[model samples]
Target: MGRNTRKRRSPLATKVVAGAAALAVGGGGLVWANFYASAHESDSSHHRTRSAGAQVATIQCPDVGQKLRNVPRGARPGVDKELARLDEQITEAYARLASTRQAQSGDSAYVQNAILGPLKSKRTAALDRIGINIRRGGGDAPGGLDRFAECRGMGADQPGNGDGDGDNGNGNGGQDQDNGQGQDGGQDGGGQDDGQNQGDNGNGAAGPFADDFVDINDVQPNSRDLENGLAANGDGGSTGSFTAVCGVNENNLFNSDNLIVAPGVDNGAHHTHDYVGNQNNNAFSSDDDLAGADTSCQNQGDKSTYYWPVLRLQDGTQEFDANDLGGGAEGNVGKILKATEAEIKFVGNQQSDVVAMPKFLRIITGDAKAFTNGVANANSSFSCTGFEDRQVTDKYVLCPEGSQVVRTSNFQSCWDGQNIDSANHRDHVAFVQQDGSCANGFQAIPQLQVRLVYDVPAPTVENGQVQNPYAVDGFPEQLHKPITDHNDFINVMDENLMNEVVDCINGGEDCQ
Candidate 1:
């Protein structure tokens, strides 16, 4: 009887001690859960103790984890691991949380105000560690930016160019730190800057966190052809003669502004034109021998020189029969150089075509047509009747500077001459003001207003995308012209800043 009592008492004592241990562990875990949430909130501190505490709370002790496996809270097996594995992960997560908190929490004015950024290795490293801990703890995975597949050792997500908008739900202009981070530890600090920089009339942002930085809208490509030489100037392809300068037409001469009326002036030893059409128009009279080219065509008081980009408001043009090689000509070149509807509309968009007006605002300002002697004009005839009318009416003003191809009634269609404030008046101020190349006397279009915009990359449509990036040359010296080649245009875009205009109608950033 004595032995039986002693055995029963010993077993009861063991059970009581185990029960007490279990209760203590559960209560401590409850305390630790609170610690986890608090540490996450006040993570800006360098609290080593807090980190160590977090490490212990997160550890997945297999003994506890397996026993609780059937429990609702343990369904994820979120922390199931042997003692060693549990310890490793807990330490890692805590260290990472500590590092990231320290990096972003730094308070420096220079760090806040830099154009590029507070570009600190510490910040980068911190972001990396946090991302690593998240992945290790099995948080949500980045969708296409698969960190495992693309990220290098000790890196974050690696998204491409257009991915800047992804995961940034608020459009706050800051990239998802884990999205664009690359192999080399956030080397390119350009993540914060918009695609284009220094807009002509843009709100200069202090930095990424500023209120008003948006996409650029008027970026133009700079070409070698702008300053030193024009594109294929000497080629039989178009503008001028191959081996010599040709005598220019006197009747159709103009200045860069297209508004100049050159007063009486000498032709400077070279044979000047009696009346020649613009290279863009291809109605040029090339029968005369080549002569020295007039170097200065933009000055206001020169008679020998006229204006450039000689725009004509043509409601109807018969010469388009010949120039529309795609429509009337027999050569395959026409088929190859076929201008699609997208290209046309893209040009119109860049020129800010009045959406309310007839889409006849065919934005033909920068369009070019090469004169292929026989192959081009084979079945078509030039507008002799139109030329005859010009000869008699406006004193034979051959392609008269600032002339209209519009029907007499449609003359007003080009531009509303009086309402300078009209949105349809063309935003030409950005051209000269931003370009920094001209004086105020840009020869004004007689009855219509001309708004000049620089950086119109010769418009093109390939692969269903309209690649007309109008870039502003921020170069200190002379501002360059548009990059015409498709590859070159894309290359410049991939490298430099460009304009992004929001469609007033659509209200979305327009980038190509």
Candidate 2:
């Protein structure tokens, strides 16, 4: 996308309350405590924590989509449309909340009356429609969906109050060591000293407060254990890898539609995504359309669709979508940054041989609503190129000069063998068990691992003020938290190419 010339107004000053303590562990590791309420918990404590003059950071609502595990195939289209509408409602409410800091500081109930109440009514209407759609499609309508209609304003101090799952407790903060940190140097480490006020970007609507960033140096080197019995080459498992040569979106295919979650609906994602591989991808694309369309991959036989939220630099550079619904208008303003390198690879399982992924099998690896939905499914990982040994899930990694930022997503590797899609879009696939074996008769499939590298200018965090920040585009209410980063994929490889991938991996031969 090209840059636009429109300049954003200076961001307004925002005051936030920090209630969590900073723990100092051995080896100089720092563990930041979480203060927000979990989304799955009741809101009684959340209400008790609210008071006049408290800063309402974002809105948190129950993830309605995750609850509908059995909508009939015929009803999914209509239900998906309504779900998309619910997202739009949240975005609208967040916009209003961001703009009304003055009123919020004065009247404690103002947010409840002006923003959340209206949002609840709209969500209730959409929920009603969803139930009707399921019934019309020859399925039993789920009840109590109305309980998910009411959203609450989350403050900064209420631990787990719609921020995340409060799992960043260990000093390591759930980081991975592989594919991390590049050896480079430039600029001072970015992050505010403990007890220092965080910087405000002034634009509350499009957030990523200064506190959202952390210096790579202060993070402890804590890496998670391998999943699915994965180990070194001596384990006697599928050890080969297959790489897909899809350039880093050089073709510049961009859209806000999500075919897997909200087919036939425009602006379903409410955020722009950089699309590679399949050239014909959008809300309305069908299997037939995709099969006939061109692709960006070097091997045309692999026409799988791969996409993820585009990262943007908040440098007041208006992008081509500046005035569009999914762009600046939805609080996702900034200069979009293309990935410097995109590595798409498929590997084999540790316990057994792998099977080919079903054609048109759709998979989503991370939670898009993680900011408000909790971190039960949060899978995005971030680190500096040279410091790959240290990764953090919630805070954006402030890469030092010369070093680049890295994002890695490892998709689920087990499938049920029958369905290509599930009612909730997750039941059809699963991650391997702790023993590295597929559970419940599920078969192991080639695991897809995507590593995206970006040469992002490290954001400056000083005296609680952030000058320019880079964040992934997401729903307005999400506030561009790094934990919300996710990836999407649809397997459309022709049988020949799919078989070649399986054989290449099973034979323990790296191929491209």
Candidate 3:
């Protein structure tokens, strides 16, 4: 199948829901009253009578890739292509949902009939193709794949909240202004608002509404405890670290393709990403291509690839990709912020001597679809420079003056020993257990930790709206939720460099 390079259609007229009242606060601050009502309420009496209890916020479909654990090697390429098609289908369906708010408010069944129904049909055909590919690869096809085709409309309060999932139940229910005293003891500003009722500023073309941010001061100190057995102190484990001095993508290596997840498919990520290290990385780059690629790292031996979604300030700046499929068209707009500092480090395991990571080993730390897939695989950490100890998983932190925004991704440290990559791109690597030991028979490998710092203007939140808000690039339906932030890495290190990394970790020394 060829790549889907079609540009998204221009957004429709702004849709504003009824019952939202504009209120003036003290000091001329303007706030929208009942901001959350637009998430579900409608103005049409006939529609209200027909579906008074429905509050569909976003579409929720089961993840097909996560369930295909036994795909044969011969079928991987076909399955991956079909999976990317599935994502495209969802993106198109969500766009239709966002563009038809008026029609949805007039008839509850319109969404079911017009959007989700067609999506399911497309997914069913794709699923059947996947089964056929598996069978052709000399493997038994998994049964009941069509069961994953059906998708449903989810409300703001449901398990998979419309725009994205939050840490707790803090869906798009409006901001909790009680000094951050909300569920889960952490304030996430009620996730991302779908811009159902706000004007041009609340346009759904690019999201990350005012409710997606919470003042860092309002957030309670919730630092996580360190992993056990990290202290070297003559411990019988690898205690050293290897730091790779990769430039912060100064070469302007950017793309919308995700080689680890959707190889051979373009626009697989549906969002722009900043890349460092390996220079020859794209949807079609093979192991040989990466091995011979130029490196952005200060050391030529480290040809590993590291990438993550770009962060953008929603200040209406027309970037280079403003009109492209993965940029403005996919709801990832604004000025792309370059990381002031990008730190990539490899550290030893706490409980055992780390082994060399296999060449071409691929690892994806966080879940890019965590907004809809839930936080079980979400590992993103958003914090401030001075307050790095305090991190939030689902909310954008409003840093104080002179404090820069920080994003940290700690990749899995245990390897399953046999596969360099897995069907889900995760089964090959696993995080250490609570006791700092690799579970099952997995072997400990050097853990990759990436830290990125951005100096951005603090967003202004007045009334119930935000100005100059910044958010990570994400899927159109995700609304740029912080929980969806993720990182990707592919190890293409030469054999000598891989050995040096293992030796340095075991020798209790830090080397660059």
- RMSD in order of candidates: 33.4, 10.0, 8.1
Model 3: pairs clashing at backbone N, Cα or C within 3 Å? 17-197, 31-463, 165-371
**Alpha-carbon shift of residue 35 in model 1 (angstroms):** 92
TM-score of 2: 0.82
Query: Candidates sorted by TM-score, descending order?
Result: 3, 2, 1
Give the local distance difference test score of model 2. 0.70
Tens-digit lDDT string for candidate 2 (1-512): 74321222111101100100011122111122111111122244323333442346668888778788789999998898888778777766766665555566567688899888988998999999999999999999887879888888764322234332222110112333211111111111111224322222433234566656778887777554434222212245788889999999888888877889878777778778888999889887899988988999999998999999999887766577765655666666677899999999998877788899999999888778876776666676788888977767777888889999998888888899999988777888887766667788999889888889998988876655577798898876676777688899999899999999999888999999
**Candidate 1 deviant stretches above 4 angstroms:** 1-221, 224-362, 367-512
- Candidate 2 runs further than 4 Å off: 2-54, 156-205, 226-234
The regions of model 3 sitting more than 4 angstroms off are 1-54, 156-158, 161-206, 225-236
Candidate 3 global TM-score: 0.84
Location of the lowest summed lDDT over 10 successive residues in candidate 3: 13-22
* TM-score, predicted candidate 1 vs. hidden true structure: 0.14
lDDT of 3 by residue, 1-512 (tens): 11222232212101111111011112111122222333453335323222421345557787788778788999999899888888888877776666566666657688899988998999999999999999998888888989989988764333453322222211112222211112421112333234434312432333465666777876666543334222112255788888999988888877788899988877788888898999888887889989999999988998999999999887767677665566666667777899999988899876789989999999887778776776656676789988876777677899999999999888888888999988777777777766677777989889888899999999887665577788999876666777778999999889999999999999999999
How does each model score on lDDT? 0.17, 0.70, 0.70
| Clashes, model 2 | 25
